[model samples]
Target: MSETELPPEPALDAGELDADDRLKPEFVRSVLDAVEEGDTEAAKARVEPLHPADIADLIELTPADLRPALAAALSDRLDGDVLAEMNDWVREELLAALEPHQVADLAAELDTDDAVAIIETLEEEDQRAVLRALDPDDRAAIEEALSYPEESAGRLMQRELIAVPEHWTVGDVIDYLRSDEELSTDFWEIFVVDPAHRPVGTCHLSWLLRTPRVVQVTDVMRREQTLIPVDMDQEEVALRFQKYALISAAVIDAGGRLVGMITVDDVVHIISEEAGEDALLLSGAGDGDINEPVRDSYRSRVRWLVANLFTALVASFIIAQFGAAIEQMVALAVLMPIVASIGGNAGTQTMAIAVRALATNQLTQSNTLRTVRREIVVALLNGATIAVLLGIGAALVFANPQLGVVIAAAMVINVLVAGLAGVLVPVTLERLGQDPAVASSVFVTMVTDSMGFFAFLGLAVASGLVG
Candidate 1:
């Protein structure tokens, strides 16, 4: 079947799918029932109508033990597009079961970027085997892409794009597009290149369709275009696409020659992947994909927990310094956690905002001071609001007015400190060339917890409430 046409899908009842059009429990079970029964035709018929993305989702949603059997049952129906859409862990597992030559064939069917994504996931020896199995041209292209830094424009861009010489008239451009069967079937705009193969301008298909046939391509082309550096980071590329509202941008080599093109579709994936990746990193949760292996998940998460354990000790040590005071007044011990909890939560809120701003280029060197000042004001307001509520509650609950004043003062101090740590930790990490998302949370949590305990307990002792 062609890319657009698949075998007709079996008729599904309205209740067979979820509100989001995802395969519902009953539908998935039905497909699994077919596969379990060794009914290949039934399985194919059931999955035929689903989009490639949905098919990928089905593969992931299936039980891991049954995945291989399901894949075997629907082997002929699975394609590169479906593979591209599958979760990396799920796709990797499936690919591991395929022969090198079979893997190469699947990669050949995908766009270069998607193909690279598949190939890059293979073990080194397996990657070599797959590369050897590929055709020479395909091998060369994938090899070049692999050589580039991972997540760079070279790795994300597609080799296939329409680039016409600037000298071509509207008629000539139209004729070439019509006559060239190998040209990419999907594109919004045609790039106009110089004699040196450097991109000079771009002409939208809509513009070409409306313009007079005699008009020169250069005359009709937009000279101002967002040209992406081939070595630019994928996150930065996504930012440029978002900032400029670009549908597609040309990727150029160090010599300023057009190498490939990154469409908004590719940028969309990058944005999503990066966003999820940062979120996972912030929590030290690793990939956080449901399909992630238990072992991998354990390894990614345990180290963070260990670090948090050490940081927790810092707070414990602070509390120990006020041990006498805490023993004298039980209320101090009881109220300390409330202060720490609120402060940690506040810090997390600020850290999330700072990390996102850094990732999206919303917070930069030019605006860093402004952003920091804005966060401080927000933190102060948040601290005061929480302090008043908590202080009143403490006074009423414990019937200790002196304790209320001490706790209130401590709340404001710790919250302000938490806010500073939140913004500063991420910003400093970024400046030092570290990922703000990865280690910022760890440090921020440590700061908030330690300072919250110190501020609260220390204030109670100093105010004679604990003495």
Candidate 2:
């Protein structure tokens, strides 16, 4: 089936496991029931209704304490596609729970990339045992993939791909495809390669099937194809796929010989990961997978909160500067928080947009100034709209029109500063070769909160509205 047409899997029912979500709770209960009964037939029946992805999600969602029972129930039915969909943490746990030979048996059913992903999570000793359990050829392929750097194209690309000699006629290609016992499953295109086994061009399966049998493979092939280097980072590989709108691209080695192929399907996973990773990094929440252990979750999130505490202290220090003003005029204390809160929210909004744009390459040095100007303009309009409403409210509440004017002016200043800081901080951080998403929020919040307090309270004191 086409990627878009792939059936929905619904047995996982993990976090956000509302009844209406794709993976319903009822299905999860059914799977557990079957596992408890030690009925592999019933377990497969329960899962047979779900998609491979959903089956994978179900495996991941099964409580760690209950996984061995579930795995034993599923038996050989726990296939490659299901393994591919499992979260890393859960996958590792499951692999450890199984014997090395059992893990190797299941992994061997997968494509080389999926197989590598599964085996890589095993303990080093377990990994060695699993590798030894596989057939020599399959073991060699997995070892070759493990040799590559983590998250590189070599580790992710499928080793199976169809390639043909440029000299072959359609008739020859047709007969070969029909008779060859060893063609890769689910290929989109047939690559045309030179004698050195380097791809020169590619022919879409649609074109291959429609052409006259007498036509040479080269006659119908498109020579201008995206060639992926095995060593390219997965992020760069995803960028190339997005930029070129590629469905599949051939992976070549140092000698420019076809080694494997990377598909849009794999790119989909990379895009999801990179996007989710940045979101988690921005919030100082590492990984953010629900299956992650509690200690790990706390360890990742607390450091960021500690950093936020230091930044919050800096904002508080600014507030201390206007202590006399706040003491003399209670209005200063009430109004100060309003300014900081508004500016903090505004800065967060702008920062989120900038970070996303940077990830998508929609915001870059070329349009950095333009983006900054646009956000500043946005802040000005937002400030004016909010200030008018707030100023009028403050005037009536405090029974002092002058106090309203002080706050309104401060509001405008703080918000405009927020917009500028929001864009500039992340952009500057990125330029300095740091991940803008990783620590940008803390810095932007510090600027907005400190400036908001200083502008509002300091102005009230300077305006003689307070002793």
**Candidates' lDDT values, in order?**
0.90, 0.86
lDDT of 1: 0.90
lDDT of 2 by residue, 1-467 (tens): 53212233344523334434535556676568656657667677656656677777777766677787887777666776777788898778777777788888888888888899888887788889999999998899899889989999999998888888999998898899999887777889999999999999999989988999999989999999999999988988999999999999999998999999999998999999999999999888988989999999999899999999999999989888878778888888888889999999999899889998887788899999999889989999999988888888899999999888889988998899999988998899989999899999999999999999988887787888886
| Counted clashes in each candidate structure | 0, 0
Clashing pairs in 1: none
Best by lDDT: 1
Report how far residue 292 has shifted in candidate 2, in Å.
0.5
CA lDDT for candidate 2: 0.86
Looking at model 2, report the run of 10 residues with the lowest lDDT sum: 2-11
Estimated TM-score for each candidate? 0.95, 0.91
Model 1 lDDT per residue over 222-337, tens place:
99999999999999999999999999999999999999999999999999999999999999998898888899999999999999999989999999899998888888889989
